[model samples]
Target: MAQKAPWKTNRRKLDITPLLVTNHCPDNIWPGISTQSGTGPGQNGFQLKPGETKNQTVSEDWQGRVWGRTNCSFNHDGTASASGQGKACLSGDCNGALNCRVGGDVPVSLAEFTLDAGDGHTYYDISLVDGYNVPMAIVLQPLENITLDDIPPNLTNPSCQGTDGLLAPQGYNPYPEYPDFLRTNTSYPLPFDQDVDENKISRWCPWDLQQTPPEKPGDGVYPYPDDNIQRPQFNPCYSACAKNNQPQDCCTGKYNSPSACKPSEYSKNVKSVCPDAYSFAFDDQTSTFIIPSGAGFEVVFCPGARSTTILSTSRAEMLQLSQQGKVDKQATIGLKRASASKLRRNAASTTFRLDRTLLTVTVVLTVVASVHVFC
Candidate 1:
């Protein structure tokens, strides 16, 4: 048998859409403590500070962004489809007092043989929805040959690590043997050589450090006047499970939640210990590829305002073109112009005449021929 040329295989194009949203709010302020130790001079022997009566309202903005991608393949027989979706989210206060929460989800769908064009080309269509309440969406289309090697790897376990961990490496300096030490340090594992060609698969899970109980005043040096020696330190296991909304190990021997484990301290380490996971092709599997698909929308939020500006762009021109009558003429024209430029630059060596009449006639004939061949 003769070797086949790579270009001779069927070509496929993937389409994707993603959405994004953002919101902002102000910060909060609390009253300061009084410096006077004993009762102050007043009618009742304790006087209230002049300015302490009022409660100050600190304003803050909470901003969030969400997006998803979809992909589809084009069949020479006129039908085009593929399947892929990705989602990401970010939330935080504009004043920087509060920590940000980020998360991502990738959902995949597959379509079996739906259309067949014997011209060495098969068609698949994939669509994605962010499904979140935020005002954001994105679409992407990736073109490829129909060969099995052209399929991109799936992205699973997507995640986001907020800036809260900036102090983790230093603040949580326990030895590796400690469970909390492992939780803080065991970020997704990387290959020792950091080379894709390596065959080993590396993985890491978050662990928790064991909190040491505070020392009693009599057991150590004289405690400070304000020190609370008996104050309990938190237990790592109970703290972690609680913050995640998981079943608390409080009663179970396997996972115990002692009085020492404060919910506040437990919540502080959640994002740090739970970084996102990303899988990549090892060097040996470099033949793999990743194509993103989706329609994208940009929702910009102004300072101190709750409303935002929403703008949508094309993920695949075909999808946008299919919706021509539904969208504004200006949007359609812009998409058409952009699509024409992209096709000219990226399409295989074949030349497509774009003169209005000629292009319409050509497209009509191609569609008719495709229908007959597939039927």
Candidate 2:
């Protein structure tokens, strides 16, 4: 028997929707991807500030995850150094640099993905097996085939059957024209179960991971236990049986099989909140789900429980807005034409404000650059 040739496999390049992220937290949290597979190995990892939106692209062959890093600050050395923003982080630190060259430090909540690989179905999941640092969620970018009808917590309504989800209102809407967003919302674990606001499941600091340190210590010294596991300092919510590494606890040795790896107290705690999420390593039955190719994905940190949209319910409001947009465009065009006409009409006599002149020049340059790039 002859082995299959390389080219025989469908080496199609599919564009997974660019990741668009919005940080709802007041404090800035860095978000990054540790892209491990595909031709773009070196081309992964970036940072985002609070309330900032970033658009990114990933290849179909890409295998990696998106995670949020908190309480990190950079220095002149380009390493994570002590600054007013603090150093490294409480969780999800990638070496010392902002761009993660490798996977981030563990105990992180993750939106993991393996695109166009293995069985070739786009696999995605929200993993609590590493333990949760921040409240996170991921939902499919609605394709044309699906409509945003499911009201959340009822996964079968729109039939996101095999996929992971908690049906809530669309948290983030990228396209105004495509307002009917169908997404999968995973149930948050533990303290993240409740809604902080109508829009979100839980606040970023659901419960302080570490006890507050009374130390008004010296420079570069942050408060609390950090990574130290001393008495009273260790996070009470830390993964109990799993972290302990016992066979019955972590589900190893004899308990390695799925049926044997029963949920321990800690695993049950996670399971209670996010019943569908991967609570442990062998919780693969409910953890993994597949999306079709060309479907977009967003791994949002601090995902709100609900989403709000600006699109009006009435046809009247939508019509008014539409007309207004057209009018605005026409007005802008007329103004540009008039300005150009004036410039040509009386080159010597006409006077234009410095600001207006600069604006005109800027618009012309923008148009030229756009043409250059697109054309």
Highest-scoring model, lDDT: 2
- lDDT for model 1, please: 0.20
Indicate the worst ten consecutive residues by lDDT in candidate 2: 155-164
* Whole-structure CA lDDT of model 2: 0.44
Model 1 C-alpha lDDT per residue in residues 161-242, reported as the tens digit of each score: 1111111111111122222211111221110111111011101112232222245563466665423333321111223332
Clash number by candidate, in order: 73, 9
TM-score for each predicted model, relative to the true structure: 0.16, 0.55
Once fitted onto the true fold, the runs of candidate 1 whose alpha carbons sit more than 4 angstroms away are 1-17, 20-91, 95-157, 160-290, 293-375
Q: Model 2: number of clashes?
A: 9
Model 1 clash tally, residue pairs = 73
